[model samples]
Target: MRVTADLDLCQGHQMCQVEAPAVFGTDPDTDQVVVLDEHPDPALRPQVDAAVKYCPAMALAVTD
Candidate 1:
């Protein structure tokens, strides 16, 4: 799977960070969503999907 975040669409809600710290985080300098791992472990897919779904600004995307 592949994950991506549209920085312009992020609202610094941090839900992604809270849901998948290993795969997503907040960029201190920009206050934008930062994708830590585009291709995370399969075990982490669910958490990543949760993060994507929880993003208030709908900034996160996940694809095969």
Candidate 2:
């Protein structure tokens, strides 16, 4: 699946980073979510989905 992060909506909560570090990260300079991998391995879908679901700002999304 493919992951997407809306920086404008991101609050830098770092939940995504915690759930899926390989797919998401934090931008120290901007304190926003960074899409480390727009497209991640399918095996990582559960973690990615958790990140998206837990994002307080609802800035994360996933698509197949």
Candidate 3:
């Protein structure tokens, strides 16, 4: 699966980090949510899905 985060739409809520710490995080300089691993391991699909679902800004997208 693949993950994408729209910086423009993000509010830095950090929900992605909570769900998938290994695949997402906040950029210190931009203070925005960043996709640490766009193409994360298959094992991380569940957490990534949760992150996308919980994104209040609707900034995250996932695709297989």
Q: Assess the local accuracy of residue 23 in candidate 3 as a C-alpha lDDT between 0 and 100.
A: 98
- Backbone clash total, candidate 3: 0
| Candidate 1 lDDT by residue in tens digits, 7-63 | 888989999999999999888998988898999999998999999888899999999
Candidate 3 per-residue C-alpha lDDT over 23-62 given as tens digits, one digit per residue, 9 for 90 to 100:
9999988878988898999999999999999999999999
lDDT of every predicted structure (CA atoms): 0.93, 0.92, 0.92
* CA displacement after TM-score superposition, residue 32 of candidate 2 (Å): 0.3
lDDT of 2: 0.92
For every model shown, what is its TM-score relative to the native structure? 0.96, 0.96, 0.94
Error of 1 at 51 (Å): 0.2
**C-alpha RMSD values across all candidates:** 0.6, 0.5, 0.7
Query: Could you tell me the C-alpha RMSD of candidate 2 in Å?
Result: 0.5
TM-score winner among the candidates? 2
* Number of clashing pairs per prediction, in order: 0, 0, 0
- Any residue pairs clashing in model 1, and if so which? none
lDDT of 3: 0.92
Worst 10 residues of 1 by lDDT: 25-34
